[model samples]
Target: MHNEGKTKMIPFGDLSREYDDLSIEIDNTVAGLLKSGWFVLGKKVEEFEEVFADFIGKEVFAVGVGSGTEALHLALVASGVTHGDYVITVPNTAVPTVSAISFSGATPLFVDIDPDTYNIDTNKLRELVVIEKKRRGNKLKALIPVHLYGQSADMEPVLAIAREFNLTVIEDACQAHGAEYKGKRVGSFGDYACFSFYPSKNLGAYGDGGMITTKTPEQAHTLKMLRNYGQEKRYYHTIKGFNSRLDELQAAILLTKIKYLDTWNTRRRDIADFYNQNIKNKAITKPVEVSYGKHVFHLYVIRHPERDRLQAYLQNNDVQTVIHYPLSIHLQEAYKDLGYSQGDFPVAEKVAEEILSLPIFPQLRDKEAETVAELINSFS
Candidate 1:
């Protein structure tokens, strides 16, 4: 019964409004592309890669890939992750984090998260490294610290342990476009940085897109070859690979969006600040950011003691919200066979029930934030 031209009853993240203007840019870019007639592995991708590499302060050697998942898989592969080797990571993360490890023919050794940042607990990671050294009889090989929810993990401790174990740190920076740790970008701090330009991310393409950034020229070359069927030249295969190229269309769309990434991320930070200042619900615990990083606020997740009741209240008020993850990876049907019981990762287990993501997209107006804050305060 809603009219055709009205705003949504309430938008979770109004991705459409952004596309109207962005569509024109994409169309023009595509037309130029069609006229040029070079589609795969062309100048557009190269240009964007250089720009993106510059953005992250790394050497210009990012291999554009199919999706965030593929970028992660390729990074692991480039880092020499193989069958029977285990990649240590947190279970309270996106499925792609674990899925990419599985895709790389490695087992993902699940770890618990820190209660505050929701990132892999660096202290817990150190403990596991010791356990792996003793029981597994070899190094764990790699550490993938996911910058979940647009905040960098505590990389100081994480990196220290990685050095001790000689582990390659592949940062999952998919949600953390323009996010920085100690004035250094997320993609530059780790051994290999992976970014996902999914449409909802802070820096989104029109569709699925991803990239891998490494400090070494050799690793970059390997990624470039691996994504394109393992060839330095056409019809001369060096090693087996996959069809994981980032299409020209996605690259172009991302290029345009990339221009506005910092601005949009700033807006997200502004909204998060607003949320932190205004909402005075005793049941709610706002996100805590470490001083070393500039959090991009991909999803402004808050924890509430009466979370279920708060969700219902928001629903009744025509405000749409969601849980970033309803179930921890350990409890998911996909990972149940890891032999993890409910009591295993108590922090992640408790967190899954408490975290709630409010609508905090950059385009959300000031009044919308004020309304969101007022409604939450009303719950008390």
Candidate 2:
């Protein structure tokens, strides 16, 4: 029995309509880039970096890079994470977080996430550092706390642990563009913070783009060199580096998107509130937003005991949903050599099985959200 008015399909994330919503503005921005005929790292990239640095605050310098992976890679390299160094991060994040560690000629040491926040478990991090020191003997050099699902990781303790252990803090803020921690931004708290401008990100560009925010001018300078073949001066090649420059076109597009980032993030928070207030199904657990910081809600994730069945039910009702990650990174085939097993990260493993990402974006209509909530409540 389909409802007559709410039958239209709702996508998990509709990038097409987003483009259509800002078609004219996006077209003009792209057109400007085409007319200028300057495509590489130029004025557009520089301007966006300046503006983005300002947005991050704390006088942090932002270095534009080719992608989020590259941003992490450069941040690690700049922080002196060389061959055989150990970098600690959560196993519940995107592969790129661990891959960047590998790319920096370092090994990734996995930590479990907090069940409530889905970010790095600070208590586990504190305990692990002590154990890891005994097992590996001071090889650990960094901690990359991912601000997962737009909520800040518990940074006070994480940073305190980092300070005590002498580890660099590289924030994986790819999903938390405007997220905060105790009235401060996530990127400002770390030694270096990496952001991804993937098409579906809270502050996405027209195409792939990324930025690394750093507090020190030296770190910023080092990142700039690393992203462009290690050359501060043309043909200088001071050190071996990658050709990972963020292009002008993407920068131009991001400049446009940055203008709307706060507004979009606010809308996302509003949608999350709607879902939180209305969805009363006991079988499903809604996402939690801690009071310590402002959550931007990049992906409105929920957990259900029968996640697969609920997803199927939503699909049948023409309301699309997705899983943020179905497999924990440590359990993935790519990291089988890391010597992890099924029960190693029990919390992350359990979350992977039950977590489902509901349709959430700035453009999601109130009626659509209501319809989705109604369908979810109707589930047996």
In model 2, how large is the Cα lDDT of residue 141? 92
Query: What are the Cα lDDT values of the candidates?
Result: 0.87, 0.92
Error of 2 at 198 (Å): 0.3
Stretches of candidate 2 off by over 4 Å are 1-6
- Give the clash count for each candidate: 0, 0
Question: Residue 339 deviation, candidate 2, in Å?
Answer: 0.5
The estimated TM-scores of all candidates read 0.96, 0.97
- CA lDDT of 73 in candidate 1? 94
In candidate 1, stretches whose alpha carbon ends up further than 4 angstroms from where it belongs are 3-8, 58-60
Candidate 2: tens digits of C-alpha lDDT, residues 112-199:
9999889998989999999987777768899999999899999999999988988899999999998999998879999999999999
Give lDDT: candidate 2, residue 252.
93
